[model samples]
Target: MTETSPASALLEVTDLAVGFRTMDGQVQAVRNAGFSLGAGQTLAIVGESGSGKSTTAMAVIGLLPGNGKVTAGSIRFDGQELVGLAESKMRAIRGRSIGLVPQDPMSNLNPVTKIGTQVAETLLVHGMATSKDVDRKVVEVLTAAGLPDAAERAKQYPHEFSGGMRQRALIAIGLACRPRLLIADEPTSALDVTVQRTILDQIGRMTDELGTSVLLITHDLGLAAERAAELVVMHRGEVVETGPARQLLEDPQHPYTQSLVRAAPSVAAVRLSPGAFAAPASQRLHLAETEPGSGGAGPGGSAVAVATAAGPDGVPPEPAEQNYAKTPNIVELKDLSKVYRIRGKAGDFHAVRNVSLEIPRGRTVAIVGESGSGKTTTARMLLKLITPTSGSITFDGVDVASLEKKALRSFRQRVQPIFQDPYSSLDPMFTIERILEEPLKTYKRGDRAERAARVRELMEQVALPASMLRRYPAELSGGQRQRVAIARALALNPELIVCDEPVSALDVLVQAQILKLLGDLQRDLGLSYLFISHDLAVVRLISDYVCVMKDGELVEAATSEEVFQNPRHPYTRKLLASIPGNELNIDGELAS
Candidate 1:
């Protein structure tokens, strides 16, 4: 990496300030934030969700929303001032001189247009290719961006491609003109670890080949520390610290930066002692007593016991020979599979194939895999959202497929879902209070007065202020919205909750907060969670046992400690290896 200096820097921002015109008044989004990126160097701005990282990047790229403006500062790219550059002039520099890979590929790529056309548009817009040769150029860029079958992939719409593929398409467009600078804003935030690594690797290779300076904006501290040569820590609207990536991460000077390192799952997991979930024997919840004549295992080898905890005196508890087999499973999937029939020549898509797992009562069992690995399909089957093809889902010793209308309704009350995107899962048209109360009303659990009181109680349970109950989902932040989603899931007093990528959309700090909240809730309510996620770092923190899936097959199942410390399967090891900054040697707790 080239050392950056004021004179030699390819992109330099000094004393940058950005503001947005809101209903209240001008609100400062970025304040005096400054950073410099040398040619062929990568610099990252890391912070929580509301921090000014994205705003600063948008300001530099001349892509701020209509309501936003660069109030003050100088953005000098390739020795030219850009803060007050004309719109026409900025347009010329945007695609031709400075490329941008936006955060969300689904929203960035036009759904109706073919991927090839999108790439071709950028090449044509920048005069990089003509109408006759644009198609070939499109294929060339997509292939360079690491898309397999580039020619066929180019003919598909945005919706047809997977998340990683769409991101590659965006990369193809971003680097089509081989710009001197690239701005990647949370480019891999929504992708799984393996795919995230692949995308970042591809970016590194492409940028290196073109000698492009990159300015990356992300909330992932570990990823920033691993991928960037220099790091800029942002807090609120200001840059708090800047230094070499390794030096800054190993010894973060700013309190906020320190907290971020501590809160990061990959780093924090190191501080968690083995058997972190183990509680005192007295506090452990025994969901069921040992059954007579039934040695230890439940039907079909489903039941498993919670990890034995230490006694009150800090002595390890004695192991019961038949304890695990005697325990009752809260939920079980036996040879469960789902097959979807395709309309085209493609016959049937086997989404889940004979996947079997058990979620013990009052414990979290996470199902983890890359996208299309059948993790989500297994979750949906457990929730009874879709009919299984040849297997059974047993909930509380009863087959879910055998549940009648009344029993199904009762089952619904005991098993609730917390979806991935809290903003989309919540009802935007309704207030928080109504969102929580609607479930109660549907089940006719209580009177209006009783329901109103329950709503407040649920809010307090999730550590949210009661004052926000009247506000709609639009009025709340991402974490706040997730809290509301959790509150609604708990309003019914469910014994089991299926959390599908609950904290994947949240930042490191908020992800830690939400995970802590879920842990506390489980301990207090004795709830069971069938957590589904693609993030192994997060799964290590919350899950008691983990089931690894790949291509609709269960590859490995073991305790969290076994999965993380001594993964037996090659696929599981690969997933662990893909985690960013997993090799860091940080010690001691940094989170509050």
Candidate 2:
């Protein structure tokens, strides 16, 4: 096992500052930041959106963008100065000694390349093995990641794997030759709770077994608490505080850390000291359990039920027929399904199967499922993004499919969709001012002066700086960009916003801010939402109703309180079991 060398640190970054030249002005993207890592150690840098955590990591890897440059800093890796290392020299050590597992493996991986070939390239490039050894090494590394049918899966491309599996495949590539350090950024943000545990557990176990120092950069404090030994808090391009994970989280010396830890809304209270709140085993389990029948509990009170398909004449039907509800329904569907046709070879694939559900307005609904399970598809149909293959979506006493092109625009204006990656949603060429004004312009909501004034009002509404009006999307942090996205969604004063994993990309504290922002908005505006996400903890906090989806089918839809407390569907039970908490314990379906 690799051990920390007292002679010198494995990776040391000192006095780092990064800046970028923008049309408006020179923005200080990253301020003075410093940290170090040793073998078998895990350090997590936590902060809200716009903090310099990601910038620091990129500087260390020499991956800074074109306009951004390190003003002052030094990076020493294993006694070798890396600040000015040649690309060729750095490339040799990048994966061999300092590996990187990116934020979105789906985007990072080559879509057309086979998984085994991708795994073997790392070894071949580093000169660790020959072409003949690729197949065996691929199987070995993939199996180590707990992937089933390793040999067969190895031959598939990245598109063939689920979000969690793709994450493991990337980890397998990172660990192919066992680098001294591994950088994983928001590794599990995109996966469901059940699959989330498997990925986190695998990464933790591998990092421990290989003695590879891990730098886990993320916004989720719970994830850090689960895997990291040490924590560093950064804000506005500076290191605010640093200490052991338990110490910094429990009794955080910095106000920022305290605010972040409090933001989760998980009802977890943090005490300021080591081993602060030690609950008995029974208490832990009880806290995980919430008030029962959580229907219509989200944002407004989410709606959930495990009712199956209904037969003709309002009679109770098969599992694939209908999901009945005792109360009046806000949103109802019958046999909703979506299918996508492959370009040339394999025919069509059922992206979402027959789904039937009923959700009350002013209630939050969570659709849970693995990747490609049609969670997003359901959200899209609700938003009228694409015409459903064969189903009806009735909203506010009107059939959505009945609308024409001109009418669809009006529907889009009312039912806005907030995406997962806030940065991509906004245009890079436009300033925040222009970005917000375009929608108002398209809809002709207000005059120029009214639009400009509304833009400033929106910035403050989402808790952003007034100075951010002229700034571009790239200038803002992930959290800030999300706030901007929210502002855009509200430009028309939308009634029901289709939030598609809006908070998944942000840090825990920023997540709290966004949730509070949404909740406050709903209370004040009386807005309804169809929230689609995989984070159960966040779902519990914001949703009143829950809808669980699988293989394109609605497995369970019920109140958040009921679904979390007394889940009837087997899939719902599995999802609750996967959350990263000690309170509620449900055994995973995977055989022990």
Candidate 3:
């Protein structure tokens, strides 16, 4: 490795190794990881979960959990070695010199504390300001972080803030001290595209203005490519590739990097082959040949097959044509609106507004928007969890609003839900078999032996080992938990599935698996989906038609292709543009 001068680099990590002492044994988390961030420069470490990206960052900041420790390597900051630093000394440098914007705002921020108090506490602890100037400083930082009504917002508790607002508050605290270096770990991974862009842009402006170096750790290759000057790709605890961001992405020298580029839904121009992320070579080749213009030869050895496919065959069919092609709508919403009247608030809060949509048989209609866009509220209304103030919802020409208790229960069996956080969604006390069988038993789908057999069948359908049926939720990985959730949703063989941010919590590779599973199941079982998500990229991969929501209203609606390729609404266009790594072409070529 070439030596980087101390004067030029703000933080330099060399041959870093980290490990966790589990009950089984010492598990190495990071092995031989190295990177350098120059003053005022941005460096990003990109990888899937357990690739040691976050572990490396935490080691650099001396914030590893109890079981974790830096087993080897050197972390040098501003010519000072951090590996052997005393806890007292490390604490002094932590917030004062190196700040952090953690991944989850809800977990990072104290629920009991006011936003202003939280910001002020950081400043006071670091001795950055006196009590007299702390309030003013807090307001200034909050405003700088792009929070509206900074002073009033600061007084509100964390629960009062929206997801975006809470993130802004976290940013305010991170930048309040104007630290020389900032470590942002998956900061916008959970956010909607527009809000993510806003927060990241704000961070960029603040860091640039303050001349602070940034170390960004994320699973989003596009985000890293767009935001960072340098990129380090990690896999299985090792740095497999590191170089200039654009060059590395455009022409990755490593196999893992290549797979990541191909698997990332944001970079894919079309819906992927089922299990394409993990497909065998022959399978990939078959899919490529079958897909028009995937280097498939046509008459006269011309690529004309590709060009022809781009027209009538490839373009999204017109709505009228679509209605003609598919079966009659399985579910329909007409002039749907939901309003909540707050006791003290002057005006009623409109949670959903005159939104009209349709879910045709065996099709997926995705609702895309930022948090608070009424996507969940709209789904809840459809599920009859809450009553809609006006308009109507119909399933097979029967009004769902008028369904009685028994009929409603029957309707629920036909339309099931899969929640966002799989860990929380599944009952921890139950084994996987019991979890899957409970839904079957509750609906009286079968007797004891039949239900047990059905549980085994469900496990097979989700591609999980039957042996895992005896395991509890806590014993399984995030992906496995989600598979269990999928099995439970499929227990009744629901025709319509309401999937709400189903894969958001899993790692990228696991996310690909779950998405492929969903796509495959849809094809085989003829399932209809009302999918809701903030990730436009994932939406691109899964949905047939897309509804773009903003401020509880539908701002744009079209086929996925139309919405992605030629969005008429400015908000839709902005959301598309804001997708991380959307700037990077799939082949690592320059953006169009």
Query: TM-score of every model?
Result: 0.89, 0.79, 0.87
Model 3: CA > 4 A from native: 1-7, 272-325, 342-344
Model 1 clash pairs are: 296-325, 296-326, 297-325
Q: Provide the clashing-pair count of each candidate structure.
A: 3, 43, 2
* TM-score-sorted candidate list, best first: 1, 3, 2
Q: How much is 210 displaced in model 2, in angstroms?
A: 2.4
Write one digit per residue (lDDT tens) for candidate 3, span 542-590.
7766788787777666556667777877888888877877865545565
Cα lDDT tens digits, model 2, 450-528, are 9889988888888888898889998787788899999999998877888988988777777867887887787677667
Question: Which has the better lDDT: candidate 1, or candidate 3?
Answer: 1
Report the number of backbone clashes for model 1: 3
Candidate 3 least-lDDT 10 residues: 300-309
Q: Which ten residues in a row have the lowest lDDT in candidate 1?
A: 287-296
Candidate 1 on 91-202: residue-level lDDT in tens?
Answer: 9899889999997787789999999999999999889999999889888899888777798888889887766678778878888998889899888766778878887897
**Model 1 regions lying over 4 Å from their true place:** 1-3, 130-140, 143-152, 161-165, 267-317, 320-326, 585-592
